[model samples]
Structures are given as C-alpha cells and as structure tokens.
Target: MASAVKDSRSGYGTLLRTPGAWTFLLPGFLARQPFAMLTIGIVLLVQSTTGSYGTAGAVSATTGVAMALFAPQGGKLADRFGQRAVLLPGVLVHAAGVAALITLALAHAPLWALLAVAVPTGASTPQVGPMVRARWAARLGAGPLMPTAAAFESVTDEFTFVVGPVLATALCTGIHPAAGLVAEAALTLAGGLLFAAQKRSQPAVHRPGSGERPRVSALSVPGVRVLIVAFLGIGAVFGGMQVSLTAFTQHIGQPGINGVLYGIFAGGNMLAGIACGAITWKVGPRRRLLVAYGLLALATTPLWAVTAVPLLGAVGLVVGLCIAPALITGYTLVETLVPATARTEAFTWLTGAVALGQAAAATSAGQLADGFGPSTGFLVPLAGTALACTVLLALRAHLLPRRSAGGAEAAAGHLPAQVSAGAEDRERELARA
Candidate 1:
C-alpha cells in the first residue's frame, strides 16, 4: 500500500520532467499572478484616492465583469489564431489600460472615466491560465500526465491567490497606493511576453487549412454548459468566504484577524491541491467531481452557525480542502468532454463562470452581512453549492462524453485521432495512479 502511494505521488514528478515544460511553466506562472492581483490592486488604489470603499468596489466589479464577459472571446480567438498572436497585443493593451486607470485614480478623475478604462484593462488581461491548460493538453494529450498537470495548475492558482493579495496589499499600503498596479503591469508585460514567445508549447491554431473542422463555441457543448454552472457555484464559495470572514472578524472586534482567517482557508486549498496532484485515485474524474462537490456542499453547511474564531478556522480549512478536488476534477473532465480544438475556450468558460459567480456572491453576501449579520453571509456558500449540486445531479449524464455508433468516444465534437485511441484505458490508468 505504501509503495502504491509513493508511485501515485511520483506522477507529478514524471509530469514536470517533460522536456520543454519549464519554458512555458515559468512564464505562465508570472503571467497568471496578475489575474489574482488586478482586482485587489484596483480596489486599494481607488479607495486610497477617493476614500470610499463603495466607489472602490464598484470599479473593481466593473473590471471583474468585463473580464468575465470577454475572456472566452479571447480564448476563442486564440484557438482560431494562436496563443502568441492574441497574447502579444493583449499584454500591451492591458498594460496601457492599467497605466490609464492608475493615472485617472491619482488625478481624482470621475467614476465614469475609471469605468471606461477598466473595460480595456479587464478585457485585455492575458488569458494565461486557460492558455497554459491548453498547452498542457496539447503537449500531454489524453494521457495520465494530464490529470497531474491539471492538479499542478490548480495548485499554482491557489498559490497565486495566497500570494497575490498579500503582495498587492503590502505594496499599496507600505509603498504607495499605485505601487501594486505598477508591479502588476510590469509582471503582465514581461511575463506575458515571455510566455507568448514559447511557440513550441502553444497549442496549434485551427485555421481553415489546418485539417480541423470549423471551430465552434465551447458553450455549445452540453457538458461545458453544465460545468460552467458547477463552477459558478464554486465561485460563490470563494466570494462568500471573502465577505463573511471579514464581517465575522469585525463582529468579533478583531477585524485584523480577517487576513489570518482567510489565509487558513486558502492555505488548506493549496495543500489539498498539492496532495491531490500527488495521489493517484481509482475513481473516474466524473465520479470524483460529483463526490467532491457533494462533500464541498456538506462542509459548507455548518459555516453559518459557527462563531468562535478557532472553530471557524477549522471549518474553513475543511471547506477549502473540499474545493481543490472538485476544481481539479472539473478541469480533468474538460479533457474528456471537450474537443481539442475548443479546449482553450472551454477552459476560459469555466474560469469566467467562477469569476462571475464570485462577483455575484460577494455582492449578495455583502448586502446580507450588512442587513442581517455575518452569519447570514455564510449562507451564501451553502446555498450556492446546494443549488449547483442539484443541477449536477439532475444533468450529471451530460458530463459523460458522447460515443458514436462504432462505440468510439465522440468527446463533444472530436478529439485528435491519437487522443481518441485508448482514451478510456488512459483515463482509468490516471484514476488508478
């Protein structure tokens, strides 16, 4: 049993050893950090200049909404064109937009001007996370290493969330209100350019003569739509926690403890992501996703009733632990349910769903905390997951790949010929690893 466990954990090491993997992985990490930093940086700078949290949140929401709306489109373009073609101009535009936003905030410009610039700032943000996942798919195909890669990427994402806000907060508070944005812009430009230059790692573009069928929107896939809804619920958990934890700390008269509480939650997520990537499971990703999400809902149920700090921290840790498995499994399912051609767009859609869900939950939870109490805010996570769990139960069949008359996997549209062969055995092997 111990030997099996060690073998399972070695999967990540095997995946990282893929030649040329580090070239893109390093730049991708740097580029993806901006996604976690942008909203917080904007909030800090705008609040410092205007002395209004309300105004600051509004600007940040504008950025989030814009990013959610436009990210899939960017992914679609990258699919039809190439990652470099889209990302090169995207990083430049994003940098300019961030500069404009910082300049406007410092000049005390009207909310309208800030909103205008926020659109481009968010829309032009490089789709590095999705692009990186697409690269993993292209490089690894439908192999055992794919799942490990997904888990690794989730761990990377969790780490960024942990680090990005802290770094942004420190820069804005300790250095200058504009320092966070400045650092964010610099990272986006440098990291994005470096990531884009790795053409060998980028997924092949599906042009007319590339022998690929005309690209379709990833949303057309039934499974992709279902996953989006599931992800939205997951986003609610994050958003609810952010607001509720703050309100809870304030309610307890130790508002400063909010950061520490949230850190415990995020830390659990990172640890779980690492462990999840290390251990090979015997269950299929579809089954694992359902089970993980159910556990997530169950974990969140007790949150509204907890008041003590230590107890809250423990529950938060459990809830965070539940999150990474569901997330990693969901991304793994995308490989089986979406075609290679639209995989990047599918990834972006799931990511966008999470952002949109988080924004909505934060807004609703904040209002609830203000009207009722922090405990009421905690209800958002439970409600979100419960509602999503219901949908997942009702339409769980959609999560499976479609098989054709010959008993071959259809996988939404179609996978590359090489990936289609023996896909099930590979998936089962991945599960057992």
Candidate 2:
C-alpha cells in the first residue's frame, strides 16, 4: 500500500496511465527549446543590428503589449475555430514577421519599422505555456497529475531560458545575427505546425450556454484579474533578475561566462520544480505559495551582498530555485479559481502580465545599471518581489473566493467544481453531436 501510494504520486506514473498524454506533452518539451533559441536569437540579432537598445527594447515592449492585449482573443479564436485553425495562421504570421524583422534589421531599416513588425509578432505568438497546461488539464481532469505537469512545464521553461541565450549568442556572434533569425523563423514554423498537426492536442470543444457569446474577454473575470496582477509582479521579478545577472556578470570581469552561469541558475530552477511536484501534495496551496514568495524575497537579498564570482553563482542558484514552485503554485491557483469559459484567456492574461513585468524590469534595470553600475540591477527584482509580497498578502483574503487550494476539503463554492461540470456537460454533448 505504501509503494502504491508512492507510485501514485509519481508524475511519470500518472502520465503513463493517461491515454494520449504523450501526443500533447512530447511536442511541448521538444518544440520549446528550438522556439526559445529562435526567440532569444532574434532578440539578440535585432538589438545588435539596430545598435539602439531603446529601439530593441521598444520592439520587446511592442511584443509584450501585443501578447497581453490579444492573448484572450487568440484563445477565443482557438475555441471558435479549433486549435489548428488558430495555430496555423498565428505561426505563419510569426514566420512572416521574423522574416521581415530580419530583413529590416539586416538592411538597417528605421527603428519604427521594426517596432511595427514586432507588435504582431508578439501578438500572434500562441500561448505555448498556457495551451500546454490547459491541454493537460483537459486530458487528466486535474489532480496530482496537474502539479506534475506544471513541474514539467516550469522545468522546460527554465531549460529554454538557460540554453536559448547561449545558442543565440553563439549563432549571432559566430555566423551573423541574420543567420540566427533565419534559424528562429524555421523552428517557429516547424514547431507550430507540428503541434497543430497532432489530433490529440486539440483543445476540448465546449457547448455554449444560452446568452453566451462564443467570444469573451478574460478581463471581465475578477479572479483572472487578480492572477494577472500576480503574474505581472512575478514577471517584474524575473526581468529584474535577468538584467541584474547580465550587469553583475559583466561587473565581475567575466562578461563572457554569464550565459554559463545562467545555465546553472536555470538548472537549479528545474531541480526545484521537480522536487516541488513530488512534495506539493504534502503542503496546502496557500502555504506553499506564501512560503515560495517569502523565500524568493529572501533569496534575492543575498545578491546585494555577494561580490565574488563564485559567491554570486552560488547565490544565484539558491535564488533561482525559489522561482519554479512559486510559478507552479500560482498557475494551479488560477486553474482552481477561473471559470471554464475564461480559463484560456485567464492563463493568457497571466502570461501577458509576466511578459509586461519582464519588459518593464529589463528597461528600468538596464538603465540603472548603465548609470550606477551593474550592481544596481539587483534593486529592480529586490523591490519588485517585496512589492509583490505586500500586494499578495494584502489581497490574500479575496484572491480566490476564500478556498483552500490543494486542501483535501473542498470549499463550499469554487470555480474548479464549475469547470468540472462544464467539462462533463461538454463531453456529453460532443458524444451526441
């Protein structure tokens, strides 16, 4: 019985039992690395070619805005037109945008041209993380399996952040930035196409209720709104961390080794995510979230003290470990709170919040680093996390209908039960239709 209980908690065990799980999960991990490489490569290429950090930054900003603003619409389109219909067009558009950005950057076209091209690039890019999570939830119907899947997604994301920069830097510096962009375009097209091609990967179709439009905005939902704010804070912390790392590495006379150090940092996050999945069942969601955020704040403070390269790297790894579980817990909370009709959009909003926060932190921290030295970059994430903690703490009572997440006892009223009913009703109708 003890062995059976242990096996039940194993993420791989749960995944093995779920039919068609691999068809969806496999593409995400495989496709993400290439996609991340391309995305980072393009960003590096654009920034290098333009010779204007401001313009390059603006392009990123445009992309974030597009992603945040149009994410729900994109999700809605998926609901209305099927995953393939939404995904293929978005991929082609992204391919075209990358081509244009590369051409313009190579040709030394005006900065405005790049920004114009970039907005759509950002907007059209599918919500890869959210889509994957939603698909998993749709398949497994959420239990211990959901946390395991969340760990997988977080670890994959960490890996992408770790490797993509190195690949981008190597390709851009070794060959030409344009070569990197071209590679990115190809990967995006292939990954997007491949993901769309899998029949099991399609989002479950739902029957609409009376007075419900096929199209709806996630902004209209209260729980989604709070989650978005939380994600924004999270994004800010991440962006600040990236800028801080870049500046700190350069400051310590090892600008060249920043990528390698970042990889180590990412490795810690991956480890933390995997571990979190195994133990998350033991802690209630609220406590896990509170502890994660509190620890993240504490982890960040030591960077302000470390001066030596070895110490910095060690401190960074410790700090990075706090990120994944915090993120996973936050996402799980959203799943438990958001309405079925708005789940996709809510997830997108969370993604957008993070993107926006990252962009904001990057800009602010980069500027501060430029003026006051790289060490100043720590100020961004340090303050960002502090603010995030305060805000979350202040709003904890109302964030999600006062339910205890991951607790064995269900709340009297909560969104997860509603989602379950919706899924059941939709499944029945699909059989009939």
Candidate 3:
C-alpha cells in the first residue's frame, strides 16, 4: 500500500520538477480566477445596483454567451500567431471592458448599455486555462506526464471555482458592490501580461508550408465534437447540484448550510482530482473516460430521492468524486487525438461547451426548483449525463485517430519532439513490467 501511494505521487513530483514549468503555471493560476469570478461578480453587482435578479442574470448570460462564442476564435488565433500576441491584447481589452462595465453599472446605465459592454468583457477574457494546457503539451508532449498535467489543471480549475465565488461574494457584500469586478480586472491585467510574457514556453506556431493543406477548425474533427458534448453534460451536473443544494437547504429551513453542503461537494471534486493525478493508470484514457462517466451517471441517479441533509451531502460528495476522473481522462484523450496545431482550439471548445452547458442547466434547474421542488431540479444532472453517455457510447469509435501511411496517426508526427521521446520511454516501462 505504501509503495502504491509513493508511486502515485511520484508523477506529480516529476512533473512539477520540469525546468521552467513554474514561470507560466503561477500566472496562469492567477489569470484563471476571473473565469470563476466573472459571472457571479456580474450577477452580484448588477443585482445590488438594479435590484432584480432577472436583469442581472440576463446581463451575466450575455457575457457568458459572448465568451463561449469567442473563446475558440481566440484560441485559433493563438495557434496561428502565438500565445503572447493574442494574450497581450486580450487581457488589456478585458480589463478595459470590465472598467467600462463597472462604471456603467454604478451610474445606473440602461440595461442595453451594460449588456453591450458585457460583450467585450467576456469576449476578451483571456483563454488562460486552454493556453496553459497547450504549454504543457508543448513542454511535456504526448507522454505519461501529460495525463498528470491534465489532472493538475483539472484540480486547479476545481480550486478556482471553489475560491473564486467566495472571494467575489465577500468583495461584493463586505467591501463594495464593484469590488469583485475591480479585483477581477486587476488580476486579468497583471497575471495575463505575466503569463503572456513567457514566450520561451509557448507552443511554436505551425503555419502551413507551401502546398500544405490549410488549417481547419478544430470542430471539424469528429472526436472534438463528441468531447464537447460530453463536457456539456459535466457542466450540467455542476449547475444542477448548485441549484438543488441551495433549494434543499432552504427547504430544510437552514439556508446558511447551503454553502457548507456545496463546499463538501466541491471539496470532494478537488480531492479526487489530486488523487487521480497521483495514481499511475494502466487503463487507457478512452476506457477510463467511459467508466468514469458511467459512474457519474450512476452516482447522480439517487440525487432526486434524497431527503435528509446528511445523506444528500454524502451522495453529493460521491458525485463530485466521480467528476474529476471523467474530466481528466477527457483532457488526456485530447492530447492523443488532436494535432498539436489545433490543440488549444480544441481545449477552448471543451471549456466553452462546459460554460454553455452550465448556464443552460442553471437556468433550467432554477426553474424546476422554483416550480416543482428541489428534488425535481436534481433530475437535470441525471438526465444530462445519461444522455451524453449514450452519445459517447454510440460514437466511441470517433475517439481514436486514424492511422496514416507512416504507421502513425496523422497527428503523431505533428506533435512536439518530446512526444517521440515519451513513446520510447513508455516502451521501456512496458518491457520492465
């Protein structure tokens, strides 16, 4: 047991030890906080100023939709030009947009005006998470370390979600209504600039050579499409749990416990992410993704029936624990299935899909909770994951890339130099086993 524990942890130790890894990772973490903070910050500030949750939600939804639509375009540009070129301008525009939105909100500007500024704010939000993943792929390549990196990033994402909302809420309530947006803008500007400046670690831009095929959109790949839908289901689980937990607490006459219950759920996700990163997996990522997703479906199946708070918390934690493996495995498959050139774009697609899905689920779940009950609201996640799992199982073949004349997938050679080295290392490890 001790040997297994040490083996599980060694992957992260070695991954973090990679030379120059910290340069971008630190700033990336700082920059990513705004993603978690943005929607909640907007909702809080707008609700305080306008005195209507409906209006605030509309404005926030506008921002989310704009971000979801434009993030992939930014990723494509990053792949074509370079991360620095895109990120520098993106961060600046986002900061300026945030400033404008805050000012307009304080002045009690028209809803249309706030919505207009929101477009730029969200559209210009830096694609920091996807860019960081691209850096890891460039630095570590298609190797065992890549899975560890994906797990670490997933953990980071879960952490930001856990922290960001709390921070935003505190700033909006304790400090000033605009404090959350102000802090979000400041982080975006500072962290994004620092991250963008790390040119040494950025993926090399892969412009087509003469007579080569023109670069295509990442969505053209069937596998990317499948993964996007799968991610959407994961997002639904998040949205559903948030609403259902809040309603459950309110229903039980202990509204304050909503935060605690939700914390337990998200904490489980973070712990699972840490553990998933530590273990050295023998099973391939494709199999892991399917199994993890199925388990997620199974775990969520009982949510609608739980009446006791303790049982609810226990079930929510188990559901949270099931999420990380699916998320990490899905990301690992991206490294193998997509070419290096379009990888950042592919990551952004998945990220955006999650955002879109979360927004939709939250809206629908909120309605179900309001109209029917908290228990009915819990159905959204179960329905979402089960439906997505069906699609994933039906289209599982698209997950694997086609082999080319050179006896490797077309994407195999397009990867970084470290990929071939990692393949060789895998062969040695297998032989030893």
lDDT winner: 1
Model 2 is weakest, by summed lDDT over 10 consecutive residues, at 1-10
What is the Å distance of residue 175 in model 3 from its true position? Answer: 3.2
Local accuracy of candidate 2 as per-residue lDDT tens digits, 201-255: 6776665668544434556656566666667777766666665665676567765
| TM-score-better candidate, 1 vs 2 | 1
TM-score for all models, in order of appearance: 0.87, 0.84, 0.86
Give the Cα-based TM-score of candidate 3 against the true structure. Answer: 0.86
lDDT to native, each model: 0.82, 0.66, 0.80
Segments in model 2 whose C-alpha atoms lie over 4 Å from true places = 1-10, 50-55, 207-217, 247-255, 401-433
Candidate 2 colliding pairs: none
Among the numbered candidates, top TM-score falls to 1
Q: Which candidate would rank higher by TM-score, 2 or 3? A: 3
lDDT, model 1, position 81: 90
Worst 10-residue stretch by lDDT in candidate 3? 1-10
Which residue pairs collide in model 3, if any? none
Cα lDDT tens digits, model 3, 1-433, are 0111111234788999999999989999999999878876786688679865446656776777778789899999999999999999999999999999999999999999999998999899888999999999998775657778999999998888777766776687678989989999999999899898889999999998897767767898898999998999998887677656656665778755655676777778889999999887765556668889999999999999999889999998999899989988888778766777889999999888777666666666666776787688799899999999999988876775544445444444343434433443443343333
Q: What is the C-alpha RMSD of each candidate to the true structure, in Å?
A: 4.2, 7.2, 4.9
Candidate 3: residue 177 lDDT (0-100): 85
How does residue 425 of candidate 3 score in lDDT?
46
